[model samples]
Target chain A: MSGIVIIGAGQAAGQAAASLRQEGFEGTITILGDEDSAPYQRPPLSKQYLSGEVGVDRLLVRPEKFYVDKNIDLKTGTRVGSIAPSEKSVTTTGGDRFEYDKLLIATGSRPRILNITGSDLEGIHYLRTMGDVDGIRESMGSASRICIVGGGYIGLEVAAVARTSGLDVTVLEMEDRILQRVTTPEMSAYYHQLHAGRGVNIMTNTTVSGFQGNGSVSAVLCGDEIIEADLVIVGIGIIPNVELAETAGLKCENGIVVDDHCRSSDPDIYAAGDCTNHPNPLLNRRLRLESVPNAMEQARVASANMLGGDRVYAAIPWFWSDQYELKLQMVGFSSDGDSSVIRGDKSTNEFAVFYLNDGKVVAVDAVNSPREFMVCKQLYGKAVNAPDLANPEFELKSLLN
Target chain B: MPQVKFIEFNGTEHVVDASKGESIMVAATNNLVPGIDADCGGECSCATCHVLIDADWQARLGARSEQEESMLDLNPDRTDESRLSCQIPMTDELDGITVRLPEFQY
Candidate 1:
């Protein structure tokens, strides 16, 4: 049976396969992944995995034996070269063609490369895959200093790991402050102080002109000033892997354009995860989220729809980051809110920042405050009293009732 | 290795062997037992790995950490026996531990 073929083995691809089986789709399921390893979780690649807290076995979303027992044909190290929509088939770079009754594109995303001089230096790296982290870990053993470009979550996370490993860490951000894109000035300042207090050299409003080294990267050149570094990690951002969809006559915007059902232009073809710019009914807008929750939930929705079930993907986007002892849990888009209220003492390092828009809660950034973060997930678009929200003594659960 | 008994919401039970120091959530996910999402990969950040410890084994499991308690308190389905399975590591004393998966994670 030419049943289902899923491309790109990631959270979405693995989840789609599992959900399909759970939905009792008694058909052939094949997952094609370009990476040699089976479907693994990438979230920990920057934190626990890089810190040696977790091993490769723990990174796997499911055990290797799972695919075997579930009768799934998982093809690893197979890169798809092209897709023929009319024929409903995909050809790999190795010239193998596979036909599918239903095609799921979970191509995910890749790190946006900084194409400046010395970009191809050996010590320069980006943390998007397992192989990349392995390279970084190898370099960290001999290296004493690490310069991370971009002050986003990945950069800050890497910096935390680097500092904890006893390496000199410097974070270079082109923006006025770190985490400028996703968080507010106050939050950015908090993280900046947090990193600085941890002995990390954080440089804001700093731009890296290029890298300077003999063979490997020895320094990051910022105009005339040179920041000495044995290794450099660029976490600028990620670009959606939408070239395959674009070439196949599918709608392509910043990402592969798909409806709420995760269906691309083609009726039989579906897309999920970072690759698809799907619509979120909760947010009332189309967004491409590089989040595990979004990926897994979209996979479930797409899988159910593939099996003739109508499941809408309408989940509030939430994400978390681990930096030392702090666990930052965020829900919804903070940008959607007009004003934000601090729920607890930031000095204690246990507080929740509630972002409200017109008296309705829009988002929340909870640091070491999972109780408030969990309640905030359910408080989206609901009107909340400013005084009650700001009072730490008042339980957030009461607002729900 | 200690044995973990995972009961699904629908009453299907699957017992799997778990190594010492491995969390109950890991044992379930590794054994291909459905229900435990553990989306954060045992970070204790995501409460998707919520499970109810068998009443007989509750006292032996010890109290939940402050973080786990806060996370569990947010769950509407959480009872007194509720615990994030990722926080419970397997040990020789915890052999034959029985836990039930909630009907829904979110």
Candidate 2:
């Protein structure tokens, strides 16, 4: 009996159910989604949706008819409260309980809120869901000034959109540069120029002291000054939705700790997505990836393992970001790298930066350069024999077809 | 433009048009092929555009690069028949090609 119950119906949860069926698992499958809508695409929220290129219906992950055709029970508008590991069941906040032979916790993550005054203001928004985007888009029209907290991908993307929409955009980041935590120093500097050239004021090493308005966030308070703002968007980071797993007595570290197979400490239970931290062979560390590809891959692998398939969750880490016609694609973990080399002209908006750890190619960040990005995927475990940044003779096809 | 037949796991037939110089990945993306994600814009950074060339016409396609050959190892259900659609540049000689997407891509 499959009797598989998946919680938090995002990409991972939805994919796990589909994968389980695809793997020939004949067991009953149930999906619980907190959002009222069916599984929808999230990446487009900041790009097409935020830019008003698409509508809510277009963001749907799949057609409603497909769920019925798959013989899967998708329960929307449902919030799974707590899990009972001993009983192998999940109790919903609305008092409904589901018993399962196997459980996959894909609760994912929530936007980390700014913990200062005026955070509770009316015009401020944290874009993690469709509901959040709807609110922000509706309020954006009348907004004269938009103050964004954090200069990460989400914040910068919103800043670009706000600036394009004719709003005075100011980004306050506590870090030295935008995307400093994830990308290289050089990459950060490049984006700094790109955003500033677009008329977005990026204030680094600055923290929000408080809010200036009486109730509805008219201005944001910085060190010794206040910047007028009619709208605020906080995109600091994300906190893993690990409270349910923790309350259920699962092994919890920075995220819910899972083995290579994506199975939690509770043998029958599995965890995927941002909520689960698994051993990364490439990184050689147990870390959580807040990326869609990682979440989707791990969920598929977990499904395979649950169905008696001898599949181990093994793949190099990769992530991507889209901002202002620039597509940045990254592969492998580059945090441990000591040196990096540029392969093309980033000024022309086409380049790949290869990260090397002791002469071994560990990671590559490609900005609008798909050819080198393809080569970097092939050269992941290869040694960095040629570390020259401007080597035109380095044929990417020969390196990686 | 040439028409190629794409056979799905459940035997659904999708006849798609292929441009002369565009890679199969680009053609599939143009036709909105279900499984070929081509996430990295077909740069090969992401192996999501993987497909197994039809056994009958496998030899018709050029030999995979050492890089493409190595990248094939990263694919989940990799077989000797496997090829990344991005690497196989489309041509008139490659018309009537049929490729099988891995079962996992859906």
Candidate 3:
């Protein structure tokens, strides 16, 4: 057999390679990464790595030796220019062609850059790859005033780190509140206060009209005011890398559309992680989750199906975020109509917000309450009363019973 | 690099040269030590990286945080020595630390 080939060595590609080895597929495996280093975890980049609490070595999903030991070919700093589905082959930027019996697309997502004037300024940056963070870290030392664009998880995380590092951090979100696209108003309000209390100047309903600088960014023109910034970090959002999949004649929506089996439109090709929009059978919907757990889980399922396993990927999706001393662990997807119940005291930084729809526990967002998060994971997709969950006296573990 | 020892559920020991300040979960996963799943990349949200520290090294490992305590409470194999390996950094004091992976983790 020609063996398996994985494109884009992010978390999904890394997990797919590791899973193939674990599943005892000993033929041959190859991972092509455009980054200079091996596949590393991105979660820590905004937190530990950015704050210098951890080094670059700690960010690795697995050490360089793991690939060599598993006899997996890892091509770093290489990009696949195009894919020929007819020949079952892909050509790299350097004109190297490789054929595969099974192909996995995990090209992942890129940070959505701003289209405003002075966006190309040297000081304006986006955090995505190892190199991106490395550049940000270097700039942070000399930057006393930092203006962060967007009020999402990435922006909030960077604000938390910047505040701790004694830098003047200002966050500008076009929306009325931060994380408006992802979380509930209660959760958004909680974080808004959290960052505000920590001395981060958060400006919501604020949009950066343009960047004002000489060669590097010095100020952000928002509304009628110019917010002076020594450095700027844009964390608006990400767009999935689907150009290759589109060029290959595979199905591409906002992301590569995959079935329950994580198989793409092409039988020989499979897609997983951030790049793939797969069905969430549990939610009865299709979601493209840009999370570590989702990426890893989908990759596992994709790898299994590639090895001829008839398993359907129906696991509940969970996500977590760390901001300062608070850790938010969320399970299941919470939609707008889902009525929510607060389970614990929010002031103490230990609380769990349970979102219910039609008397069924649809999702939960737990902060500092790991036990509640764990129970919520077990109770995922099950019907439960909001009053019972809201009642503090009622034991969460009893729901499982 | 500090040498950290990881013993599997079946008593297979793997000694890894862990870099200073990196978590034990990173050390294990980087070195291909099978037992530490660390599904959330050491966010302390996932209990998959749970390990039982040896009595000799318990004091040097520091006190468990409230979040770690709550996470350990959910695990069926919770013990006095059980810890989320991601929370334990590889410092010089933990150079010779030995931990046993729970059977459930494997």
Highest TM-score against the true fold, candidate: 1
Could you give candidate 1's per-residue lDDT for residues B10-99 as a string of tens digits? Answer: 999999999898889988876767898877778888899999986789889878999999998978898988999999989999999889
Q: Is the docking of candidate 3 incorrect, acceptable, medium or high quality?
A: acceptable
lDDT of 1 by residue, A183-282 (tens): 9999999999999999999998899999999889999999987999999999999999999999999999989999989999999999999999989998
> What does candidate 2's lDDT look like per residue over A1-401, in tens digits?
53999998887887787677767777789999999987776777876789898787556654565578678899999999999999999999999999999999999999987778767878888989988988899999888889999888899888878888888899999998889888877889999999899999889999898887776889888878888899999898999999999999999999999999999999999999889989987667788888888888888888988777777887777877777878787888667678887888878988888888888888888887655665666678787566444596765554543
- Which stretches of model 3 miss by more than 4 angstroms? B1-36, B51-63, B76-82, B88-106
Query: Candidate 3: which pairs clash?
Result: none
Q: Rank by TM-score, descending?
A: 1, 3, 2
Q: What is the lDDT of candidate 1?
A: 0.92
Error of 1 at A314 (Å): 0.7
| Candidates by lDDT, descending order | 1, 3, 2
- Alpha-carbon deviation at A215 in model 3, angstroms: 0.9
Put down candidate 3 lDDT per residue, A357-379, tens digits, no spaces.
87777788999888888887777
Model 3 clash number: 0
- Please, what is the TM-score per model? 0.97, 0.84, 0.91
lDDT of 2 at A112: 89
Q: Higher TM-score: candidate 1 or 2?
A: 1
